[model samples]
Target: MHPGVKTKEPDKMSPPEKMFPVLLQKNYVPQGEYEIVGYLKEAVKVKNAVGQMVIVEPEEFVKGEMKPHESPGVGFGPMEMKDGRKVNAKIWAGTTIKVPVAEAKYVVAKKIAERADDIAA
Candidate 1:
């Protein structure tokens, strides 16, 4: 073959597998099927069986229930109205809560996944 001439040959191997471990953020962790919806440089978007989307790391998997972490705080509402005039009202006490967070786990890929690049999470 001449230096300027080139021959066409099939690639030795296909595209490298993009195996990723997904993390699910749910109130309760039930062993079920999960799918990736979107992808990011550092994170991935995953869709659960219930149609809930969660963003997680690219190379990590989290499956379990969330842990409760509560911090008590006082809350006050808007002022009271009296006779079409703004007046001071008694300070109302209340509590606000936030959702729990689950720990992230690293899952190792045992085999090459098909169409793994398509999945975000």
Candidate 2:
């Protein structure tokens, strides 16, 4: 083989191609099938089973379910509305949630906090 010339056979692919794992955000739920609607350097637009197009953080994987870790920490603060004063609070990963994915329609990639009652107990 010539120094400048390259001659290497490509590897054979199995029946089904392998998919890479997708990196998820703190509050993002990685589950179910996702359609590749768009692509970006940082993330890709994917449609979940609900037909909702959302941005999926780029990491790896094509269609699959994944359980992400808890979200970031958040503190509660006081806030007043026009109606009256209320005990508004900031929220972080207060609980563990299971996100299910059906088809490539919509994506459920968001962090959520557990209920106050659940945490209180």
Candidate 3:
């Protein structure tokens, strides 16, 4: 250690990449009551049954090439304010989140059944 040298300040650290859990069942889905606790650049985070968290983009979750029946969804709905306008939730860069999945109530079942019927047809 040099006696006359001044100590340098430590650099600030950036946040780690967030991750969410993957629910791999047709009956699992995100509900419409959840809120986005954090925002990421084109990504969202969620926890799975095994306690593993993962990150995903809005397009990957909402409108990507991935089939809705195959991947999980972020359980959130359009948010309406007192101004009579609805706000759609989004994930931006550096957002932390906890995505929840609900039991596929009916629509998912109908879609699966419809697909099966289409195959038969």
Candidate 4:
């Protein structure tokens, strides 16, 4: 600890990167809702499976390379919202997040959206 040295802080209020709704498979651990906030610039470790470990590298954290529109995702643990305090989520692979737009749901959503058009007419 150096009294003369000062530390820079992350821009907590900075707008989040472009995000897309993603599905965290119920089968995966620490299941919940998550979004494709953006590709990970730094390498991170995740639980690929029980008793298994996988390191998601920066190069591997890509979008569209794995079948189009679908990108890998990560799960976060609890987080604190208070200011002046720093906290990082206890992250895990959480059964691996295969984040991509579900086409089936898109189809349903399209139909529902059409109703709005009908009402406008």
Candidate 5:
């Protein structure tokens, strides 16, 4: 035993236990409760008086394509928040976020409402 280091007695330690449950079947699907981890962009299209269609307008919009993270070993990894914070949650394709079933429905509804015009068209 080293004099500089302190050691704990075996009797004082707690018994070992599993943190997560073990699955009996190998074909089990996990519940959706994850966060989206990647870059995103919000784009809007406006129609002019002459009915001209424009894709990218620098003056009125910051146009850019939505790009995802392309790093290996990032499958079902953590997601980055709008406030530049990284959350420890598994996500899919860095786009479709696997959130709670109820929350997922809410998110979809909210998005549809926000893009009502696009849907109508």
Candidate 6:
């Protein structure tokens, strides 16, 4: 071992396993299904929209898709909002979106986890 580095003995009971990092930010959507090891980074609050705040942090994930699943029979690509805006199915990894505070608390919390597994067969 190098003089500048420190080393410790392995645990007797548990063997070391390969580990991957995952990020779970507040306003950011997860790319795909991942076995989240732990919080590599904490969520940070950022100003978004009028009188609302959203979490804008990037998280680490392993072996996941950056694009969202499209439903069957959905006409064209991307999603359309009531205000005539388009929401792309492909969200760049580590990107954040501003959501309504109330919706974020209730809806996003539940949906984020399932996003990765929401693909059509």
Give the winner by TM-score.
5
Q: Per-residue alpha-carbon lDDT of model 5 for 69-105, expressed as tens digits?
A: 3576544444689999776643222142334445444
The per-residue C-alpha lDDT of model 6 at residue 53 equals 76
With a 3 Å backbone cut-off (N, CA, C), the pairs that clash in candidate 4 are: 47-93
Q: Top lDDT: which candidate number?
A: 6
Better of 3 and 6 by lDDT: 6
Each prediction's RMSD to truth: 22.4, 20.9, 19.0, 20.5, 16.8, 19.8
Pairs of colliding residues, candidate 1: none
C-alpha local distance difference test of each model? 0.32, 0.34, 0.37, 0.37, 0.37, 0.40
* Per-model TM values vs. the true structure: 0.18, 0.16, 0.20, 0.17, 0.22, 0.21
Mind giving the per-residue lDDT tens digits that candidate 2 earns over 4-87? 998887877645322222222233323432222111233578999999988877555323222222345443334568889564
* Distance from true location, Cα of 93 in model 2, Å: 2.3
For candidate 3, the per-residue lDDT at 111 reads: 46
Candidate 1 C-alpha RMSD relative to the actual structure: 22.4
Question: How does residue 29 of candidate 2 score in lDDT?
Answer: 25
Regions of model 4 farther than 4 Å from truth: 1-16, 20-76, 79-83, 95-121
TM-score of 2: 0.16
Q: Rank the candidates by lDDT, best first.
A: 6, 5, 3, 4, 2, 1
